[model samples]
Target: MKATATMVLFPELQSENDTIASQLLLLPQNITKNPCENDRTCNKDSVNINVVWLDSTSHSHFYRSMPKTVQILRDIKESGSLNVFSYNLMQSLKGGTYVNTVAFTSGKIFSRSYLQSKKRGIGNLFNLFQNGGYHVSMIDDLCWTWSAANCACGIPTFMGVKTQSWISEVVLGKRVTIPELWGNFSKELKLRGLNDIGASLANCEIMKANGITDPFFTGKSKVAICYNGLYQTDYLMSSLELLQSQLNRANRPHFSYLDINLGHESTGRRIQTLDVSLAKFMSFLGRQNNTLTFMFGDHGNKYGTFVQKSKESKIEMAHPVLFVLASNDVATKLGRDWMRALDINQNRLVNILDLRQTVLSLAPNVDVESFPINAKYDNHPNGLFHPISRKRSCDSMGIAPEAGKCICYQGRVLQRVSNQTGVVVLANFALGELNNKIQEQFLAANGNESSGFGNCRYLIGSWITNVQQTVSQNITITEMDIHIPAGTGAPQSEDVFSVTIQVGSNIPALSTNIKLVHHERISTYAVYDDCRDVGVDGDLCVCSATPTLQSWHIDPPTIFGYISTVINLTRYLYIYERRTPHGLNLETSCDSADKTFEVVMRITSKVNVGYSKKYPLTFKVKHGTIFFIDVFYQLNPKLNWDVKYDVDFKQL
Candidate 1:
């Protein structure tokens, strides 16, 4: 139930009024309060901290993909309304949204002790803001439903403050149709009459065709992270408008957390649509003389075709976008020294921990310029508001050697090692971890019954596919892919896993030096009839029942048609020609000697029913391994070659 200004409780909506009252009594007595009205004079001591968080956006991707957004941001920066700090702003941890957000909210790295304590609100920004006498609100258009701060998705809750307001798509507990949602949004637009920042309905018909009209229409409680839709952005736009109304009516200092999931949730697809809406939002903030706005990304796109394309993609994921826009009043109050520090620290090595400190420092009358000497996070003692050491590296910032690919570390001088023993050791370690995960999943599925993984057999590494290593400051980073053979009776397919590990200089010391940093199953698992949920990640499971393995040879025309259908290039007709069963394309990047077959194809554009010219294409397949076949074409001389089609052999 929504809490009102008078703290009235609706009997049907909630039963926790007494609990909320008791919690309010625990608040400190010295909560800051300025009797001055919400005007320019009130900004002398404090300003509302309005944070707009965009998930999974990297600085590089934001600049490259969202041209209009970048232009607006550039204009704001030139106008001295925004600060863009793109470089050296790394993620506090290597994990996904949850980990980075934890650091952002709590100002601490995630640990077992923190989880064990179960103190969700203590020492967090929510409590800090409340202590500063700010009316706190967390708003999200997708994936969050706040009921006493508990996330509906079973992740640990945020805030845990009962008085804080939650505005989310799932808050009402009843799913509405896309049209119904749009009607409500239209009514809200009429009420506010801020039509300049209207919804972006670009590609609306296409999105509808792809079943992406409603934010909550996925049949799940929350929208999936990888899902894409224009309505998601529209929902956020409407929600932000509603938040503006709330802020206007709020008398106390406000701390608003606007969790915008448009760009990142869709895996960096259709982010251009957010440019106009965000530009307007920034403009609105620019006019708010007493507001300090933070518009930043949690991290870059972690899982997508974009991230897997090149090494630069990985670097982009490490460097998230951070823009701190201080209103004119707040900027003047920060003084020249603080402004100078903000400028210098833009290029300094910073992360979510530092951002946490920065937010904490902004609390009313808090002067924690430096962290305690013995504090666990003492390495990076100050926030962006203070001067940061130029000599500080990832190590100095207490970033784990395996935490992430740090921009400060120049030791990623990769050298390919042939048949290294360390590769085998790390591969085996990763395989063991995968098997252990499978066992754990099985145990959990069966209500913690330790009767073993009933029908699932342990995966054994059949052969190593690829290995590459880099040594940076006595730390060795090894990336290897090993093909794990499916259990007997399962489909005749190999499950190739790409694993990354970090170790000390003593690579042979498998016990203490080795640490598995990242691992994922690259190949697809075709059969899981008996143990569907018992696999490491729902795909590595191999049922005990033996299925008939059928091998069929397709005609040339049939192969071409299959390729054409899967690629979805309606304007092209393909023709496949087999070179040889043992043919290997030595000129291509397919260096594996175990390649089973190679084929050449000629693709022709069909302007109408007639075929245009034929373009020769070649691809080599390593039988049952994970590989990407990229098809490129240049539509015009001035334009760069576009990757027209990509085929993942595992999916085939």
Candidate 2:
């Protein structure tokens, strides 16, 4: 017995021409012929794939943000027609949208170095579908620009099929004018009654008409329409309608990829607005037996107030939402064991690579049972067609640190290490790696560009705000929040970065001790105007500032000190200056035999102090029972001073 679901739609939001629900109701209730006799008999030409990639939405977020959509999905899953993967981890947490897309499209692991290399010749799933005589179409705003800016994975022509470009003209209204490459596609949209969508996008006029007073859209390009008063569902509806147009006349099979930036803005809270459209789309898919839909997200929130709202918000960035909806006929063809595997893999650690493999398994003449049902490492892809190891580690899945920390294991928890010395060293090291990546990206650009490396200022580590780590079996994973002076425009403003690194216990070998796994700028870098097209992570760049007069007032210089627990240490060093010197240098000397630890200096400025700043030096010696600290400072060659002190930790 097949279960039925109530169709949900927002009638007030629909146009008069013909409702989507009404149109779906007109389709055949049952497929006349089996698209594939069984899983082993399906040809690519007989299987239709409709993929909807939602940006910045995670598994937890989907349920919290869209209760209506979740209920609809639950109904489908209960009907035994849908398979939901509870643990679909993303390939990259910090690589952004472009890197994640390329990973699944090619079914390969992507790294910052790989994207920087611009290596080509890797075949993609789209090309496979095209070669199998399937009609292929991709709809997105920035997909084309992202492809052109990076590797040439044949994005424009996947197997020589020209991708449909729907930028400025369709995505942004005519208020923002730009040339359209595929002009005929716009006409096709008009014929399909989707011409109103472009005009309905949030624009200056629309904002005024709707009485929206938020300045969020002021400096942003017309393309960045997060809180534009208009619901983002407009783009989703248009894409689904366009896909519907193809299905109406599809002779063989059709593959349509809809990658939209609908839920990326507003801390991803905007996903709630997609409930009605999403419910309708899923309802329509429920009636089709030959089509398969992959609805998922790239990663979670990268920035905004929402990420700082709670701990769950921060963790969701690595846990993207993935739902695979298969028709009843397709499910039956895949067999009972495959269905069992699907049930088991939902809770296992899986990613886009596995999704790609599962799609390929449906290709023509692929024996479904050729691969073992219980094999740990199947020679074939590790898709849901077989079981994914519950013990899978991120490294085994070819995941890099840039993707985010692994959450699959139970005992690998990252706890606070309380070592300020180690935090400072690792923070600086991570910043160095970030800057090197920025420099490499800048150097890769041809000299034709005006905004080059010279336009951006290199970032420096200001202070270590938070330090955390977890060690198990001699392996350590450390996370830190470091502050830097990469702010928008304020004189004393700063930006905070969250970094995660892995290290071995070889404290003596600090040179090869720490490795950066993931890093993200938690604060906004809106001041990236000067170096707009520099081709590097814009947040990593701080535009160079014009020369300004520098002055500092130094009252009688004084030093303060205090001693706390062995696990906690605090020291304060205050410096006041009247005139800025050519340079300032800080040196530290320790009277301990072991050189495993070092001192860290934190710099701060106070506007109330009238041109005076504070410098607090903190030290930690983990190996020695007792140690002496000597510090020397020089405002300039003319001014020099030194402070020496020793304390015994053995008494504590």
Instruction: Write the residue-wise lDDT of candidate 2 on 234-317 in tens digits.
Output: 444554554454444434466667655555553455457677767877776776666777888877765555663444555677
Number of the top-ranking candidate, with TM-score as the measure: 2
Expressed as tens digits, the lDDT of each residue in 469-546 for candidate 1 is 767666777766666665544434555556777765444322235456766444334334434553234345655553
Model 2 misses residue 573 by how many Å? Answer: 25
Query: Which pairs in model 1 have colliding backbones?
Result: none
Q: What's the TM-score of each model vs. the native?
A: 0.60, 0.63
TM-score of 1: 0.60
Q: What is the C-alpha RMSD of each candidate to the true structure, in Å?
A: 17.3, 13.4
- Give the poorly placed runs of model 1, Cα more than 4 Å off: 1-35, 38-43, 81-85, 111-123, 143-156, 159-230, 245-251, 263-267, 365-381, 411-425, 444-468, 480-498, 505-512, 517-652
